[model samples]
Target: MIIAAYNAQDTLVRAVNSALGQQVPVEVLIIDDASSDDTPRVAEGLTRLHDNVRLIVSAENGGPSVARNRGLAEAQGEWIAILDADDAFLPGRLQRMTGVARRHEADLVADNLLFFDWQAQAVAGRALRLADDHVQQVGAADFVGQCMTGRSPFDYGQLKPIFRRRFLHARGLRYPPHLRHGEDFAFVLDWLLAGARFMLMGEGLYLFTQRIGSISSDSSGQSRTILNLQAMRDHTLGLLARPRIRADRALAGLLSKRADAIRDQAIWNRAYPHLRARRPGALLMEMLRDRRSWPMLARHLVRRHRARMLAR
Candidate 1:
């Protein structure tokens, strides 16, 4: 698979290292979005040391989606692995993930991730509930259900998931470049709509490195972010109009997934205020107004109940 980045000088080395260190011998293709840093230089130097790691420098910066598209074109592996430039992979990530792909004959394998809080600690996470992988006679609803939940114990942002290259090409699938926010989410939705069987791994093999000043979180470019969310929602809603959605097992999952995507937008644009630093009172009020916030609020209640259960 391909590891794509733009101006990711500080974390690029570790990202490349993780790809190279995969249990399966992988072609760790690195695409630099014409970074104005030492990323290209560093990649250049490493090419001599590692034959698996290949570096390509783009003439212009087309963003990660574009960079990823470029890498997808050049990847030779039947399965493609994606790692953001900033995220690092734990050892055995590729081995376990690829093994799943081979066993289930899955088109897409979305695995779990261990998130590092701002302090870089292993905090509480959620269950993935990913359905079993079935390739030949895959159920659309079951497949889409796993993908829409958005949290399959996996961090979708990480480049640790494996994609069947032949499946991807057959469907002519590619990420939406214009979306600065949930572009990956949108792409996955389209793939699921087209009957991509998703397999989830419970293990969190990827490390998500949250960086400050990222385009998605930059208050300075809030318009672009908002537009991206709107575009994703609109795109997903359009999928519902397609002839599919007839799968009995996945109807609920599809609706839930749509709601979850909206809720995600809410978390970034609305629910963010609930934090103490962002003015909890106003945030709580907004959450009260929006029904989408209830699931998150219910999660809090469930956690509190479990805590009480343990204490008693």
Candidate 2:
């Protein structure tokens, strides 16, 4: 299991302990990304206490993508599991997911996540309420469509999946080191486009805590997030442009949806940067850059007008 840490001293121990206490033989690689907090010292102590735990510290903070890529390079395990320093895996997570993957011959497997509140010290609920069925194999086109066309800015693309090391190595799949916020989305998209056998279990085996500084919840990082998503769209276009990809009608449709979603995001960001903006030129440029954006922006304006009428 690879845990990326950056100023995560408060909850790092719990996260590492969860992985260490799993049912399977686990090797913990904790990469401290130049955290100013006591994360380095805490990680060192963990390494000394347990031989399975290895602590590697970066001299400079290079964000989660770089940290995860570093861990991937050093990993010796047959399967790679990603555990955020602020989150945790439930008991039997590794054993259960591995069994499911092997049974379905899946290259990647992910389960639902349960949200926990840090300050309240309570569990909120499951992030995704799946069907009563046991497990389901998700098609690449369907998964990509759900991720790309959703109204949510980032959609549900941040899911952490356990991947077969051989599959990753064969495809040369690694997190884009340039992306800091939307790297997971891009990574998963790559796997989908590469025709990975992806499985989703109905059970929620990962505990995702609602924390202020987490990458997903940080409001201050919205601009960077938007830019990363734009890059993701560009990458998607490049992939879809390939002859093999263009031959797949379903995949091509998914990619088009992704492009449309990114165009909408561009207009939304320009209109409401941190909830308020006075950038007409930026909005105009966005509309001009993408032909689809004109209709999307017009629809947005209609919604706003209706909302104002209701308020009055």
Best by lDDT: 2
Each prediction's TM-score against the native?
A: 0.72, 0.78
- The C-alpha stretches of model 2 lying farther than 4 A from their native spots are 149-154, 211-227, 266-312
Tens digits of per-residue lDDT for model 1, 90-206: 898888777877788778876665443323333223233333332232344544444443333232433245778888899999988766555676666567667787776766677
Shift in Å, residue 292, candidate 2: 11
| Per-prediction CA RMSD (Å) | 6.0, 6.1
- Please give the lDDT score for candidate 1: 0.63
List per-prediction Cα lDDT, in the order shown: 0.63, 0.75
The sequence of per-residue lDDT tens digits that candidate 2 reaches over residues 208-274 is: 7653222222332111122455676776677787886789988888778777787676666554443
